[model samples]
Target: MTDNSVVYDDNIMITMRGVSDSVGLPYTVNPLELVDREALVELREGPAGSAGPDGDPAWPWQWRGDVADFSALRALNLTTADARAAWRVATENKIYYWTGLEFIAFDQAFGRTGKPGPANVLSGTAVTGVSGSAASARITGTSPGQNLELTLPRGVSGDVGDPGGPGRIQDAADVLIDDDHSLAQDYILAWDATRGKFVPAPSPRRGGPWAIAKNQFSGGTNLNEPKVLAAITIPGQPTRWRPQVTGQVRVNAANGNGYGTRCDVEVRIGGPTGELVGYGFGYDIQNWDWVLIGPRFDFPPTPTTDFGVVQPNQTITLYVIAKRVKGSASFTVDTTGAQLIVYAEPIR
Candidate 1:
């Protein structure tokens, strides 16, 4: 068999054929396809005017080009005579070759009218394909590969919000430290569990002179004990010393002897250089003639003679030393003590 290829509408087709040599044996030959010159030219021009067989006009005697108006075409009064006349004149004199019978039928099937079909009438067909029928399904039984799966194009995914700027940890730490204070307003130092050292707490809520009203005291017990509950460093202006005293130390005698025991309160004000700024001693003991007896609170008989003062460069410390002695038939001595209530500004 010989393979022959031909062009059909706007494409090519291949067919097998067998030819015999002089020996009458069949041999295969591949022949080049030939173009139908007449058909090609006629199809290019589309339908032509035709005359009727009986010398009358054909039903659609005059054919229009692609741009002709369809509505106007229907109004044309073409008849059989027009078609016959056109066919006889053209065929006999060979003025133009005739389109095959099938081609003629194709042109007049709608009787001198044409209209736009579908936008996709040529859908699924590849132009310039092997055959006029268009590139059809694979005929050689070639298997199709796996189906292609489409996905979002690169960088075309969902919108992602921009990342927030990193937090400023160092700045935040500085802010926290700024708000913290070294010691309490009236508290000099406090126990810190984490650092295992005395941490300065903020100043106490109270301030100024902290007083003590003594009520009772045993022989040598509890008198020398300080009533100054707390001392704190002042913030902002840091030049003055501040200490606070609280609670009371009662001075009542424990023994009921001839005369109760006597105790005196003294305040000493000085500086680290031993410069005395003020001094005060209150005579709380009685019986000064024989060896003071009885429990008493003597203010030096006058404020001018007993008041304690603190100079700008001095600090104050107070001591309350109480001693009692008996010179009668029995020998007895009692000692009790009390501390002073010292008030001052904060010293940093």
Candidate 2:
């Protein structure tokens, strides 16, 4: 009898062939079972020794092979489709795949169902209780089979809105500041947020306060105060001033001897005695005529508060002096005790 109890490739029935014909044995058949004594011996002791690897040392079934041709032994397909499907399901359920393969969550394969629907279905996350420029947050959930959403809150601020278009310049006065008749042409102004006020126009370049008058001969605008050129007083240095004119200085009689004489000042910054640094000049009024003032010589020590990071002790002093040609009259040339105010402000 052929070994009918053995499991072979499911398609190959080991006993389908006549055992007697195949094994050169006389086959005997009974109603209950077919038996061939010689064939049974052959099956038990053939080149393919036994049914299982554990039972037989020379078993043909002891080794594994490509299952593609196993159809001859089995009726069912043995594809790993089920395992792959389970992995995808695990990715969808976020039970295993998310914790394992992070890329799976971002990929369309994991969450994509072959369907025509909205990409995402989350409602607006409204921030209910917000006070100032501090803290604010909201929560929202998406629709079924929708992509994840990430929302963040912004903190409070001291100001509001997109900050409307810059303020309009009403007139020439808004554009000008501390302007004397002597032409100070170029100037700029802007709104100061910290100080909550409008700052006067700044100089286009490093120089005197930019001023200009239409007519120089007639002297139309009578500028009362002395226009400050540049002033730096390092405590240890000499304070000097220079007159605008180099040669003979004269006061127009309309300036009333010295009353109408206005002296221009040139300030030279340097070390004490006569070490040159930087220089600037502006008109200082005597009576009213524009008279030359000094690009002076003066040296003053650097103060701790003024120059940051720059070592104050290492810095040399600034020297300042006032030099002006004598007036046709005594007082016209005299600027001994003239008042000067220099205001320096920073622009961001």
Candidate 3:
């Protein structure tokens, strides 16, 4: 027996021998596969409406097929008969086209007919049952049978209020009289009748009279004796003032016993109860011959610190204290030509 088998070549092209494939092997050939069979059938059948069996009109292609331009549209046989048929089946204000599968209808009224219209103007004269100028119109009455008016209402004036109470006025006799002699010399206090107060009288220059106090002491003195040489009483209560003090003492060797001696002098500001507020002392005054021992000292040495704020009614005293530090012989402090002075002035 022979090997009855069919062989397919790598690049074989099988052509159909007839419309039906039912014959012996050498008389017919069958293809293994067909590429684009549907497209091939459509192309072979031609477009719809071209013709049918026995030359009758096929289904009329109502819509133009995927028209590219006016030339393609004009190519369709759009006779009166075809146009009338298309108009009956087509939608108004809409166009149709085929997208390979089905027809897609685009509504021409989508944006045009669906949009809103322009606003209307309001007419004042058209308003019913109301009356006013056409330029400024309002509703007539709020309810039935009521008429509206246009006049503005005026408000009535109120009565005058009662008179206010009288005020107090001062005269020259009503002012107090002050006869204080201590009132500074070049200054005077005058009464202001209108303001009911005492104001200082105006002067050509500033400041009042100067207040000065001084004391001097001259007498014989002994050794090792503390004596209050000069004293002054400050009048004001807790005032700032300046005090100056000077002490002069002559030392003599008794019986020609030439010996050395030291003398001390102290200046102090004391309160009413003798409490020392401020004090300064100077010592070591040597004497071999008859010598004068004295020095002037200022309390609070600098002008910046010169003002000594004293207690109420204080007394400032300058005292002399002497001692024979080295010699066994005694010495006498003679004040025959010696003097102790204390002076004070108010800072103001």
Candidate number with greatest TM-score: 3
What is the Cα-based TM-score of model 2? 0.18
Which tens-of-lDDT digit does each residue in 226-332 have in candidate 2? 23222344221111212121211222222443442334334333433343333333233434343343233244423222321112123222323333333332232
Per-candidate local distance difference test: 0.33, 0.33, 0.41
Clash counts for the predictions, in order: 51, 64, 0
Off by over 4 Å in 1: 1-206, 216-286, 289-341
RMSD of 2: 21.2
Q: Candidate 3, after superposition: displacement of residue 57 in Å?
A: 99
Best by lDDT: 3
Error of 1 at 225 (Å): 15
Ranking by lDDT: 3, 1, 2
Q: Which of the two candidates, 2 or 3, achieves a greater TM-score against the reference?
A: 3
Q: What is candidate 3's lDDT per residue for 217-237, written digit by digit as tens?
A: 333434444445444444442
- Candidate 3 has its poorest 10 consecutive residues by lDDT at 38-47
Off by over 4 Å in 3: 1-222, 225-239, 253-258, 271-308, 311-329
